[model samples]
Target: MLSALLHVTLPLALCVLLTRCRLFDAVAVDLSYDHYAEQRVEHLPAFLAMPCNCLVNLLYIITGVYWLLRGTDNAEPEQGRYLRQVFAFMSIFYAPVQWTRLAVLQRAPAVLDQWVTLPIFAWVLVWIGFIERGAAGWRVWHAAVLELLSVLSYGLALLHERGFEVALGCHVLLAVYKGVRVQLTHGDARTLRNFMFAVLSCCGFVVLKLLDLPLARYRIFQRFTGHFWSKVCDVTQIHFSICFLTNMTSRTKKTR
Candidate 1:
């Protein structure tokens, strides 16, 4: 019953907020559209693009919160400690990366080519933290596989022009594997919640990519739908993260 409610209500609520708030308008402008000669702003219709990007950014923030919470909860104390350390390290490393984004937001090629690697690098550190904290057995193996895949995806992105395609595929696989692993290992309501959250997160990204497709002739509807869907994704991430943190902090008392 709880699952059903979350599944139905959460997405609906996000959609409502996104459409009503004009989020898409804000983001499209912020993302910088002056780079591509062919990607002229005339086609975007500022009214639509602004809200679309806004909603997408909102989703990103929400997902960050969700993962932090969820990951913390499900994490063992030892694991939690290491995660914090890794997060701190990544945060420091990423500071410069973000500065680079601000400094070169106008430089599209640099942003996509160089700046985007920061998060990938951070995740590598996270995987190492997991290993150090005793995320052994199959979990360790799984993390190693993901790390390798992530590195390869980045490399492919750098080497080939079709990096986004490869990266997206890898993201999907990673999401699926993590979701299944959590559900199988935990076998609790929280695990189910995490799975749902993971699905929503992936869907959010997928929808964003779809919105960018050239098929849309009218910008208004496209922007509206894109923004709305993006928010739904963001909320799911936050919910999942919180659930993760809760699970980690409060374990079932051991039986005598």
Candidate 2:
């Protein structure tokens, strides 16, 4: 219990506290819209989108490590090995982008930001494909296609000056579709519960993030609600995603 508290709950609390620290705020990326020519504004604490995204990604890494160390060995050794690689690669590819955006290249152009984030979503789609289709059904071609669509979606958002609104909407819809499909196909109570939890977390994440702009302006919302709730939801979404995927994989292995 103590180990779980220290490793699991402690990290989450620390990350939430870290988000409010003025030091991180000092290093946050300038989020002013290039199209609008608005003066550079202070980054929002609720913008747990990428800068501090590594915090949640750390949870993913820990979860992956736990599975790799303790998960039951499957008959398909190669598949297990490959899944480990995918998890490691995703964590490696994701962390650098967050660090770069937050600290290394603080003033980097938004286009660069978009390019780095492209892989993040592509990896997500691939992970979901792995859950739904198994190793045999998971294909690079599908991930490539989804990556292309993500690029186009972001491109359109940039041109229209909405700044990833449309792209995020599309990704959320895609995630929901994937989760629903997995539940329908698997027909497991635990998987269904995880899916429902993820859906709720995703909904909260989207709503809080979208409202961050308007709500975070007010002192009360910024200090007490908007930023805090957004971070909580964002982290919850990631945690539950890891839980869902890991649970699904465990079920698959057990059934086999």
Candidate 3:
């Protein structure tokens, strides 16, 4: 338990400290925007942006724990109960995967480790599809299809040299499609906007990931820029989507 706490809590603490200290403020201004975003440092804040991101992985843990208990506490209808339970199972996996990811990033960050993160993202994609759309017949199939395609993409990536890139592209396209579908189908304006933001964040995650390796060679980007931005994009894409789901679900119950 102590070992687990250090793994999970320490990076979060450093992130909070960096945020509170405004250690990145001066650097942010120095690399200020020029409309075109030439310097990579302009994107640094996304990586280090406090509170939201600092607690993202932690949020996954909390969400996981909550889901573990949700089955007993929340008495929502049985219609989506199975789906919710599956989501809980995924959440249980997600928290540890996130911790393992941090450990890998700290010690021996590799493409393989990065690839491991994809399953969690894939699960989120499927969950959002199910929850936002209501688990009608077509919706259930949609989520399953998305999961199958995601797995196939990863499988392809593992089999070939540039397979990872191909897999990443496929997943990004699929995630965007799902987000856009929600945006179009949902009547609520806030829900629509949240889905739109989720799509953009998903794209941002892809871009940051693709650039991580290339930017690592540069002096300035090497100074924690790659890892920082990667975490930022990861948090933005994943956590915000979860918040949107939770928010919409609660509002949905309130209305009904």
Instruction: Single out the weakest 10-residue window by summed lDDT for candidate 1.
Output: 247-256
How well is each residue in 183-220 modelled by candidate 1, as lDDT tens digits? 45544776567657757775784675356444244565
Full ranking by TM-score: 2, 3, 1
Q: Per lDDT, what order, best first?
A: 2, 3, 1
**Candidate 1 overall lDDT versus native:** 0.42
**Stretches of candidate 3 above 4 Å error?**
1-116, 128-149, 213-222, 247-256
Summarize candidate 2's per-residue lDDT along 46-115 as a digit string, tens digits: 2333333324445445544554455444543354445444544444333444444443333433344444
How close to the true structure is residue 45 of candidate 3, measured as C-alpha lDDT? Answer: 46
State the weakest 10-residue window (summed lDDT) of model 3.
28-37
Instruction: Tell how far residue 215 is off in model 3, in angstroms.
Output: 4.9
Residue 115 lDDT, candidate 1, scale 0-100:
25
Supply the TM-score for candidate 1: 0.51
What number of clashing residue pairs does each candidate have, in the order they appear?
A: 21, 0, 1
Compute the lDDT for candidate 2.
0.53
